[model samples]
Each structure stands twice: as structure tokens, then as C-alpha cells.
Target: MRRLLGRDHDNRGFGSLQRGTEDAAKGQGDASETKGQSPIRHHGGKEINREQIHQQIGSLSELTITFLLDKPRILTDIQTEYRNVYSLSYLSDREFWTCSFNDNILNLCNLQGEILRSVQTKSKNWPYGIAVTQSGDLVYTDPRDCSINLVSGTQIQTLITLWGWTPLHPCGTSSGDLLVVMESVDNKNTKIVRYSGSTEKQSIQWDEQGKPLYTSLGNTKYLSENRNLDICVTDYAAHAVVVVSAAGKLRFRYTGPPSTLLESFSPLDITSDSLGNILVSDPYNDHIHIIDQDGHFFRYIYNCGLQCPWGLCVDSRDNLFVAENVSGKVKKIQYYK
Candidate 1:
């Protein structure tokens, strides 16, 4: 199969990029709110500012971490004949989901790469982003019709259709809300939209100074909400990991480490672990960058033998699953000791 990220790879251009959403169904876990100034009262009724506590905790110098840089041992590699695998998401600890390029199909597979069920998308449009809601339902975006669809049982239903903006990626948050990366119709404006079902809850487009939070163009911004409730995105166009507070305030942007190994950083998929650590794929360098919740650079997972690692997800146990784009293989790797 051709490398999905090859230089000569077909440029679908702005119109070629896909869209998707995941259900914020009730069940997996509740989303945390770490972006507020509300007072956190203890059992004895002692009032403490939540934001202050997080800042103090984040600044602690004694936070010990064992950086994992050795090659990640591949637990399993699932081979698929699909031309290009664009995304990987965990439906459960035992099973996960993946979507393909130029196709309207989504596969639910077990850890062994055996397809247990295959769900066809609603429209002929290609599915881009995918995520599992707390209730375990699948939600994805169809760029062809500018709609977000939900998969329940064998039925594919269009939950909502967007207008004026194109939704790029959809992620399920811990609070059972859905976060979507959207670009304006003209491709000059980008923002993150939070939704409860079909109702829009919040729109995160600009910083406190009213500057755009993300690059105004491209479809490479993937979304993930950290355990701390901070919104994390691997913005390929911006060449940085843009993180915002739970309340939509711009927190930090990590461009890249000062290393010669990376010539140009094109971060694609991103996910947060149980420890609140952010893991982002650096396929251009064949490695993954791990960072703290506060956007502090932690370490790199190098020599993992990962070739063009694309989609990334962390299972409940923190086991890292990587999709090797060119080889059409999904590798289950253990990165943390």
C-alpha cells in the first residue's frame, strides 16, 4: 500500500479533508473541569480556589517521572487490506474502532485485529474523526454531507448537520460532551465546538486577546481532552500542540523540542493517558512526544520502529495503540513501565 503521508500522496486539499463526531453517551466516565475559578470546598468547608490549586500542583519541582525512550514492545500488529487507515479509537479495553481513507466504512475489532463488526456510514462520504461516548456508542463525521452521525446497534443516524463551518474531528470528553474541531467554510477560521447531543454548549475559537486559537487553515487539528479537562490539539498547520483551559482560555502551545532528530514536526493524532500525560504522534520523525498536562515537555518515545505513525489512542490501562499508515498495520505497544 502507498504511504498515507507520502509527498506525492493525493492532495484532497481543503475539500478533500473529512469530518466526524463521537457520541458523548452516558457511561464511560464524567469529564473533569479544571479550567475554572470556582472555589473548591473540602469536607470541613474550607474554601480553596481550584485554579490556584492546579497552578501550585503543576509548578511542583519534585514531580518525579521515569521517561520511557526505549523502543516500545509491540504487543500485536493487526494487518488490514484497507488502502489507508486514518483513525483508531478504543470502544472498550478489549475492542477498538478504526476508519479508512476514501471510504465510508468503520470497523470494530478486537485486540487481535479480528473484525467483530463492520458498520457502514450513513452517507457515501468518507469518515474522518471517530470516538466512543461514555455509553459506548460510536459517533463520526461525514464531510460529504457536513453531518455528524451516530452508530447504535446496526443503525446509522444523522445526529446533526453543520452549516457555515466544516467539522474536522470529533472527540468524546470525560463529561459526556462532544468536542469538535471545525473550520469555517472559507477555511480562514478555525475553532472547537462543544456539544451536548445536538445543542451547542461552547465555542472555543479565540484567546483572551481575541486572537485565533488555532491556525486558520488545514484539516490536521485532532482533538483530545486531558484528564485535567484541558483541550489538547495536535495542530499540524500550526506546528504545535495547542492546549486550552477547560473554559476555552489559551493555556500554552508546544511547538517542538529542540532536537536535531526532527526536521519538521507534523503532529497528527493526540490522546491523554490516565496519568494526565499528553501523548502526541510525530509521524514525520517516526516517534511520539509525551508531555505533562501543563504543556511541559517530558520525553520522547523513540526507536519504536513506528513508521508514519498516524492515529493514536490510549486504552484504559495506558497501553498505546499506533496505526502505521504506510504498512496498514495497527500496533499495540506498551510505552509505560
Candidate 2:
């Protein structure tokens, strides 16, 4: 597959943003020069450097601006039994798996939202994440036990037990491996680890210079691997969408849109489409932001009337599924024309 953002594209605007941020982080930028300019927008009132805004605008030229006019419609809204549905994954085009944070139950439901089969978790620990493995088995994480469990045809087994780390989210990659989001015992360190069965294959934590790649505050990091194997994460605490190369190298970070409608950009769940574009849920702004693989701001899905969109997933045909947390409903939407 072609690289999501072609290497030949002029990304100098983004490069300038990266350099300016690095300089600011190292205490090298002049404070007086930034005194009056409308500080470029960013999460948490931090000075969004000019380079960052320039880069975001520069990326718009490469995007299909007309796609925004293709408004997405809610094909259907299926109500569930749970009070709050935290996570969702597709078992097939006709079926899906969902975990209830309040009821502590894992459900296998049809497109009509009818419960086909239900299983209580092995422990009182609520399942925070869920995914379907290559073998069609269901895998989930129990934060209380720090264990990753697999369920095949009603038989539940412990696949891996994390000793010092806490697994928060689990996603199945196209290569049949599993990518898990984890946190340290103190919750001050967070990372993503790739596992082949029970053996750890790779760990992504720090950058080349050894600085932590993600914020180390909470276990709200949701992850999905793109078609090109770039690991995409929605960091709730950092208020940014962080993407890294398959080798765990930091590629780019996208802080939400630079619109006045947004006060804070807190991204929750994330998924990648067939075209390699990244879709992120921004409940704080009551809309979702779609960006290119290179982290360029594209457009917003606001006409769909989404409320507190907590979970996101894309089917094989590129159909988008959104979990509305407050109303206990799931909306199937179509964005591409």
C-alpha cells in the first residue's frame, strides 16, 4: 500500500512546527516575540507556535476538501441493555462485541442490537478494552488483574498476565499480532507493547532521544494500527492524537482543529479507514476529526448530531461505528460518497 502521506509531499511547514516546539521545550525561544500575536491554538492554553498552525493549514491543500461536504448520515441507532458501553469491536459485518463498564458484562450482539450471547468477566475488574483476534477469538483486558484474557467459544483462558504493568486497551493488527496499551504500577509511565501469543515482541515507550512518547498520567490511551502499521493513539491526558512508525519512532502529533468552536480537544477512541486516514473521537467538542496519516487537520463530522462519542471502529467496507456514551446507543454512519 502507498504511504498514507506521500514522502514527496512538501511537509516543510510541519517540520518547522516540530523544530519550533523543540526549541521552546529547550527554553530557546524568545518570550517577547510571542507577547502579542494571537498565540496559535493548542490544548490547555499552551502557546501553539506559528509553525504549528502554519503546518496544519499547509496540510489542507493535500486533503480532499470536498469530502467535508459529503455529510454522513446515521444509518441506524441501536440501543443496548448496558447503562454505559465503554468499548466495541466487530466480530463480523453482522455481529459485534461490546463491554459494559457499569454492568461488568461482555455481550455479543447483532446489528439489530439484540444480545446473542453474554458472558460475565472472570473478575470484578471491568473490561476496559476488547478486540477480535485473527482466529476469531475475543480478547480483553482486566485492569484489576492486569491480565489479558482470551475467550474462544465460551471457554475463557488467561493468555498473558502482566506482572508490573497494567494493560488498558487491546487491538488486533492485520499481521495477526496484538497491540496493547499499558501503564506502569505507579501510573507514571505508559507504553504500547506488541505481543505474539504470550511472548512480548516489541515495546514502544521512548523516542530516539529517550524522552517518553506519551503522557504518563492516566490509562486513557486508546490505540489502533493503521494499514501501513503506524500505531495511532488517542492520548486523553495530553489532549492529542499521537502517531508513531511501525518501529515505534515518533512520527507526528495532531492536537485538534484550530476552530473557535473548540475549547479543549480531548480525543478518546481512534480508528483508521481503508484510505489510511485517521478518525478520532473528540467528545469535548461534540464532533469527530478526520486527519490524514501525517496528522494534518482535515474536517469535522458535526452534522450527524453526535453526543459524547466515546468509541470508534471502522468495518471492512469502511463503515464507521460510533458509541454514544450518554444515550446507550450505537450509530452506524457513512462518510465517504
Candidate 3:
């Protein structure tokens, strides 16, 4: 958000503040000129009062004035500029999948949260977690049914069933396989599973450590294949994102913070951009954390105002869509450049 929305300059409450800074700068300039070349007995303007200097100017200018602060501009008024509904490909160029702990039957809605169509399974299978395959099949985890349903053009078929209802996140992979994060019976432990045509291809977390790694992981729903078909886990518990071989070998980990936060800001869902960056739904922090393909923190993009961000993903056009579970609204974040 450092360029467009990042430039949040409000003239509110900033009156004489501007005049005060300018007056201080002028005083410093005058004192410096009076100090000849030797400047033995002269101390220019009693120093430039570094803290008082950044009263105006943008956040990007902080480093130009001080050596110890690079604070990001805080935010407000968060609403999508435009909204649309896709009857067939509602989530084609979009990512509207979301989850709920209440375990109610979730409906497919437009950006406005209008229920387009919903299928109430035999159980209150909370399909709060969902994803779409590249070939275009809607896969969702039914907490009640404890299964992943593959919804095609008009029919919803069972793809894979899980023993646990809290399958938190289920994502479709580029390789035509499904990556689902399996929550334990207690909803406190989790593991990632790969389903290839209803067959379990791999148990990413279980196989690696003979157990699970996540305490509250959600972003493991989606994944991009590493060079060797390795799998990566966006560890929400450790406050780090990790990568592993499809064979379940530790690859790399990303544990950096974005603009210095007070507490852990983990992701609820993860999706990749054309640039190979990881776009994560950071609900508590109210922003998407963009991680470069190499697993480095890039920058926060949209930070208008968000209410309980539950799910997020990037489309082919590089546009980002977020689903607010609490507000029951879907948002499309258009990228200007």
C-alpha cells in the first residue's frame, strides 16, 4: 500500500502543524549560514530536532529525516469500488471461499453477499472452507458431512470425504490435485492432505513429522508446487510460513514481520500471483500479506478497512478478492498498477 492507498494524507487536525515545521526549518537554515566555515563557536540551530521534523511529509519520507523509523501509514473506509456476480464462474476470476465455526450450510453469494444458490447437505456441513480446481470444479469442506464436494456446472458431487468435520481449508492445486488442511478432532491440530482423484496422494504434515504442525493453521488450503513437487505449509502457529517437498521434506521458511507488528499476524488462506508472490488473508491485522515467490515479505496492498477477513486469493489478472465472514460480504480489490 506504499504507493496509492498508501498515500493517506488527511488535512484533518493538521493546521499550524505545517506552519510549525516550516518555521523550524527556516530557523535551522538561518543559524547554519551564520556559522562561517570554521564553525568552532557555532552549533547550528541547536540541532534539527529530528522528531519534530517529520510532522508533515509522507511516511516514505521518514527515512529521509530519521535513521530509525519506517512506519506504514494506518488505514479506514474499506469498501470495494465495484462488485459483480458470476452465475457459473462466480469464483473464476475471484476467490470467495470462506469458513465458519458455527457449522451452518454456507451459500454461494455475489460480491454483495446475496445467496446465489446453496446446497444444504444431509448435515450442517459448514462449507466455510472452499476452493476451485483449474479445470473448474468447486471443492468445499463440509464440517458436518466431513467431506469435500466437487461442484461442477450444475451438479455437486462428493470428491473426498474427511473423518473430521473441521477440514478448515481445502484448496485446488495447479497440478490438478486438491490440497486440504485436515483439522484434528479437537480443532487444535492440523495436517495438509493431497487428494488425486479421490485418492490420498500425500499427507504433507503427518508424513513429515509423524504428527501435525499447526495449532490454528488456515492458509495451508492452497499451495504452489516447488521445483521437486514439494509441499509448503504456511505455519500459523509458529508465526512463520514454511515450505516442504511434496515428499514432505523441510524446504524453507519465511518468518519475517510486515512493517513491525505488535503480535503474530498469520494467514487464514493462501494464494499465488502471476509474479509468484504469496497473497495471504491476514484477518486480525486486516490486510493481505504478500510474500514473494522466494518467501520474502514484499508489501501490504489493500488496507482500506476490513471486518474479519476470512478468506483471500489473487486472480489471473492479479486482482485480489477477500471474503469477510463477519460482514458476510465479498470484496474485489482492483490493482491500479
Provide the TM-score for each candidate, comma-separated. Answer: 0.82, 0.80, 0.62
Candidate 2 per-residue lDDT, tens place, 156-264, comes to 7777777667777888776677888987766567889987666677999999999999987556678998766799998877888889999999999998866646657
lDDT per residue (tens digit) for residues 93-155 in model 1: 678888877777799988777888888887766786887766677888766566777887887
Rank by TM-score, descending? Answer: 1, 2, 3
Worst lDDT run of 10 residues, candidate 2, spans 30-39
Model 3 C-alpha lDDT per residue in residues 54-141, reported as the tens digit of each score: 4554332333223211333221122322121101112544224333333344455555544555555444443436565655446665
Instruction: Name the runs in model 1 displaced over 4 angstroms.
Output: 1-11, 14-64, 67-69
Q: Give the lowest summed-lDDT range of ten residues in model 3.
A: 30-39
Which candidate model has the greater TM-score, 2 or 3? Answer: 2
Candidate 2 clashing pairs, residues 3+ apart or interchain: none
Cα displacement (Å) at residue 206, model 3: 5.7
TM-score of 2: 0.80
